[model samples]
Target: MNSETWQNLLHLESRDIVSNWFEKIHNRKLSARRAKEIISSARQGREYFRSASTASFAVRPLLAFYGVASLCRSLTLLHRWDAGEEGLKQGHGLETVAWSATLSGDLHLALASIYKLRIRTCGGLFSDLVTVTNSRTVWHVYDRAVPMPVDNKKQKLGQELCFLDILERLPDIGNTVSGGGNQKWIRLDDFIYSSEFGAEISVHGTPDHPVCIEYADAGFDLSKRNDPYNSSAEITVLKADENLFRKYLPQLIDTRVIRTMGGQPSPHLVSKFPQGSWFSQISITYMVSFIIGMLARYFPTHWSALMGGEKGDAIWPQINAAQMYIETALPELILEIVGNSIFDNKEL
Candidate 1:
């Protein structure tokens, strides 16, 4: 953000600023306390977007901008609370966020749900429905035509796919793909693994049975070597104290190289995994698809737009073509913000 943008953002009149930053911005100044308030509020809004349950709101710049802030916030927590002989507890993630977020989403108060998710990340708030992860990897639950990496030489999307048909999109679920391998996405409804952290249907911890199988590799071992996964490896936990975490997690969506503390290791603790992942967001996409499907069934019309229909009647080929347009546009909109975080190649 430029100094000029800061001046404007620092003098907002309302908490929920409209989506006009691109066009309706200009030079401005405000009270020092007021500037501080806008700064704080901006961070709060940004954090809310990162773990928001619905993708609908995430695309909005105000909320989407905070994706990095939210990720760093959770990383801070995972680093801090992971200490002592008791072991690092799994923190509730996306699965639980959707339930709370949905209630708020109904009222367009997704911000509250974001706040709740932040609390959950830091162990301040939790859900009884599921267990969380000790090491959280930000998983982008998307497929096909993903935005190409900015720095990566390859910009073309290597795969062509229909997302909803290819792999189920789990909105309110959590899955950990640690102990790396070339597992090119597979159905994860029932597979399992264990860790050295806490374990449960709704908690984060090491799976008691640390047997890993690399689905992507031609030949891989599915056996436990160290008592816990990565126990023999030198993996560092960044955030390790909950008390220290509250100070940093709710940061603004501004670009800053925010990192938590690390450099500690203790004996291994065993955690278990009954299943690889779980969900909470009531699969609304299915309903959306169904409703659209039913509309086509009851209000059946314009089937002439079907592919290669140009030879017959050119009824609504353009509208049908837009379906392809949206499939590609959505991912780019999401990645633009996320990519901002992944790269530091430009001005920090």
Candidate 2:
């Protein structure tokens, strides 16, 4: 996280600032009692993040996950005030139904043999948050030729999801989770808007490698505009008039608007997966953190072995990346969600 924004969040530790911020977002008469809870919850969440920053990777996930949970509680308070404190008391709304580790005669092999971990949604705080953000999928990150929502509406609660599959969907660590393959998120170099050709917006590919941006909607022309500098690079440009561009303006904005700690935004075009197989970035964060925290808390022997055993070298980098995401990216995401909920312009 940037130092300036981190300091700004620290300032919210002041009760007066939090209270004022809360009231400002609502722009209405405030509830003194609820205001106190929101202040306390946000403080608690920040402290957890602070503590997580100091801890070693061995135990960091636990602290970080709880910190995220606390922040989510604060957001929940802001969004679902009708539920009140009683709603905040609900369970995590997620569970690890089955996790199996295969054993070999060699201790190192046994330690490395964590075969599978699966979790199910049990309808609690986490589930509620997922439902609220379900509309914003990986599909929303692009303009596909066939613009159909991935049909996840019928996705049943309590249906188990492979822990690795969900972990593989994280925008940052996904490549690591996929055995060092291509990134699930393709970061765009630029989105150039031109009015010369009736307001044409070009989706530039990452300059470092060749990319094929395809399946644009009808009336939007897709031409092979490869980068002249790199013979192998493919740049997909979508052409549309000002009116048509306005139709996709919301999605285009969302695709580019990943805010940093100081409210600096970057553009990353995401890849789409099958319906019910993909999730929004926030849900992925919460679910992954929850799984790691649960493992650290409940499976002490295995967790310790996984951290220090033979495969540790390979796994530690991903673990460290997860921690970094929790520390830096997670807060920005929470702020974004809360800001959107309150219709606030700024995310502090």
Candidate 3:
């Protein structure tokens, strides 16, 4: 695509369109918490776009559209919630739940878009990807290049963190674990209250920022820690001979770390790279086309109501035009970005 086309694609109409729409809706139907979640998701999508813009050219369009699609999905969910609440107030419980499930599925697709973009950028390197758990924990050692799974529920969010701890200890580029595996395993009580490690392990930035493991010791405590993951106590192993520890790292990970206490791997673990393949590209194009068609056919009146109340009719034409472009032009652009041969032959 030329520079003009890129500019047009990035031209998200006017910033005021979404902001005004959100403000009007926030004042009208959404609760404070729900409004906040919607705004936060929108902000995250923008942040991801900003981050993607700084990335190399090969994956820029994928990342940029991933952000745009995320914002679109969030707005669609907001619309669904607004439409569903009327029925909800009228005693349609099942219908309300169904609407919420649809919203959840949209959230899943937003994540999937990001996951595909990341895979394109990183060639599916597990270490470079950040696995976002259903509980919202973002697990990754690297700061950038973090890839989240499309389906959060299937991720082994907690075990992945443990697995990262093991990876951090391994002999890699720039990592040097102090006592190797032989460092004395700190007691759970000792590690938690140890003013030393406590001072070292302070939380910084927002929860979305990468978790810092600096100056932290990993050892298993027999008692459980106060974490949502419900991980076992005494899970960290501190001290072992360097050579022996290095030799057994893979075995330890395979036998103890990757699986849950129940000894089953997370069924939702995202191990396959489905994006950029011919089938995946076609599927995404078709899905986007279908959604655009639906919006054009059914959503203009509803959107007009949301944007301008009962008298709002002006916004429908703009929406219709946008949907038309999405159906006719956006699919080809997306296929061009994602269906390229360069992305197909990449190895993790």
Question: In terms of TM-score, which candidate is strongest?
Answer: 2
Candidate 2 residue pairs that clash: none
Q: Could you say which candidate leads in lDDT?
A: 2
Give model 2's clash tally: 0
Q: TM-scores, in order shown? A: 0.21, 0.69, 0.21
User: Local error of candidate 1 at 141, Å?
Assistant: 15
Off by over 4 Å in 2: 1-3, 11-27, 100-115, 131-156, 174-176, 180-183, 189-222, 226-232, 237-266, 311-313, 341-348
Candidate 3 C-alpha lDDT tens digits along 1-348? 224444443322334443444444334545555545445545654565665547643334345445545443333334333432122122100111122233233433422221111101111111111221111111221121111112322322112111112222221111222213332111111111121222111121212221111112122112122433333322321222333222221110011112345543111111111221111222222233233333333334333343343432333333333333333333233223222211232211
lDDT of the candidates, in the order given: 0.23, 0.56, 0.28
Considering summed lDDT, which 10 consecutive residues are worst modelled in model 1? 250-259
Give one digit per residue, the lDDT tens place, for model 2 in 294-316: 77777666677777755533555
Better of 2 and 3 by TM-score: 2
Runs with alpha carbons beyond 4 Å of true place in candidate 3: 1-27, 82-348
